[model samples]
Target: MAYRVQGVVVREKDAPATIETVIVPDPGPGEAVVDIITSGVCHTDLHYQQGGISDDFPFLLGHEATGRVSAVGEGVTEIAVGDRVILNWRAVCGQCRACAKGQPQYCFNTHNATQKMTLEDGTELSAALGIGAFIEKTLVAAGQCTKIDEESDAAAVGLLGCGVMAGIGAAINTGEVKRGESVAVIGCGGVGTAAIAGAQLAGATTIIAVDIDDAKLEQAKRFGATHTVNSKNEDPVAAIQALTGGFGADVVIDAVGRPETYKQAFYARDLAGRVVLVGVPTPEMQLELPLLDVFGRGGSLKSSWYGDCLPSRDFAMLIDQYKLGRLDLDGFVTERVGLGDVEASFAKMGDGTVLRSVVEL
Candidate 1:
């Protein structure tokens, strides 16, 4: 059977996200249907609206989500009805080379449902990151549903579905921040601030937050940033150095995808420190730096895709931390909103006042 549900969709390039009647079909083989409990309005959803991600019009927005398994398709065994889960885009194919190498996090062939959700007119809607959840219920590859703690706050832990996971994974997974290390994160947006929280969770002694917004810098402090640098007034690299005993931080994460911010992250780390880029850049953005500097830097340069996270492992662990009050996942939730407020939340994103505007069903 099929169900008609209201979902947020962008019908044209540069169009506003709107509520539409989405037709969610019954789960096909290897697919499942989820009844969304909460979903986060992420910048990726905005990108979908503005055509930054793809030209697929009538794109179903919202990927960061937690929900329950309402129905399962044939061949599904890992999850059953009523199971609470965090939705993940990467449904790793275990036979992929990356998975065979014991690094399934880099799975080359991630899975998405072959069946498409559509409008009443039968126009297929592209699911953002293949896990659109702004609607009441959504269809996805069964593997995309990572079973999570039933008691976890859907509004908080569901963020692991995207941006929050990226940030925390940038520091802990990709950057591998160690205890007593000095860490600096550039771009104190949700992801950047989450990087600070990751560093703190990993026991970094000093965590520096950098951004142009002073208020955001203040917000970073609550996430365990020991020093805040308003890059608007001073050279961020210099400020980071000053905060780290005149040297540089052991790990520097670039959460802003712009080339300028990447350069700052490159120069703001110690000679042998790691540089991790967790930001999502546009196609037109380009980077040019001295090859000699790259060679002389003597440190690793890495890009974090989904924070290099393995949802099967990371999500449950992070949720455990959130439950233990070690990770402030709740703090990341700036406001709770409904599906109608998603488009408005996009406007609030630029103002730096909100970290995440979660849509609770």
Candidate 2:
């Protein structure tokens, strides 16, 4: 039987998201229906409403979510009913070349539910990132659900579904931060702070957080940054070099994804140091650097897509770390709001007023 549930949807660009009744079809082969308990309002959701992502009208907005499996479809054996899980966007196909080479994080073929969730009028709603979850229940490929400890806080762990995971994975997996290494993260939003936490978790001795806002810098300190640089007032590259014994950091991550910030990240690293770009840039934005400097840097210049994470491996490890108190997942949750408050939450995001405004269903 089909299930009708309330969800947040943006019918057109620049329109406020409204709570509408959406029809969720029963799980088909290799799919599962999840009773979403909590969902995070991310920048991606806001982008969708603003038409920054695509022209997919009436897009189902939220993606970062945690829930329990309420039903499973035929051929779905890995996840069972009542399992606590976090929904992920990437469900790798093992046959892809990236997966064949054992780097499933870059899998060219990812899977989503074969079925569609539509409106009462029968208009098919495009799920954001293939996992629209700002609703009571959502349907997804079984592989998109990563089971974790049931005792973990839903609002906190749900962050792992998107921004938080990207941030943590950028530092730990993409940057490959090592003990006693010096690292600098530009931007103190959810992703930047997560990079700081990940750097600390990896035993980085000196973690420098560069941001334009003082409040965000303070939040970065709480996430384990050893030093803070207000880029708005001073030169970030110089500040980073000054913080690291007149030599730049061993690894620098650009979390802001602007051409200017990317340039700072490039020059703010020690010779042969790594630079990781985790920020999502707009299509019109282009980055340019001196070819000589690129060659002279002599280290890896890489972009981290979803933190280069293998959900099966990274999710459980992060959960274990959270349980052991090594990772402060709760610090990421600045406030918990209801589904109706998502639009207001997006307004606050621009000013860094809240790290994450989670929706508790």
Measured by TM-score, how close is model 2 to the native structure?
0.99
Error of 1 at 240 (Å): 1.1
Backbone clashes in candidate 1 total 0
lDDT of 2 by residue, 1-361 (tens): 9999999999999999989999999999999999999999998899899998999898988999999999999999899999999999989889989999988999889999999999999999999999999999999999999998878999998999999999999999999999999999999899999999999999999999999999889889988999999998999999999999998999999999999999999999999999999988987999899999999889989999999998989998998999999999998998999989988999889777999999999
lDDT string, candidate 1, 1-361, tens digits? 9989999988999988889999999999999999999999898888888889989778999999999999999999999999999999889999989999999999999999899999999999999999889999999999999998767788999999999999999999999999999999999888998999999999999999999988998999999999989898999999999988898999999999999999999999999999999999999999999999999989899999999999999998998899899999999899999999998899999777799999999
Clashes of each: 0, 0
lDDT of each: 0.93, 0.94
Tell me the alpha-carbon RMSD of every candidate.
0.8, 0.8
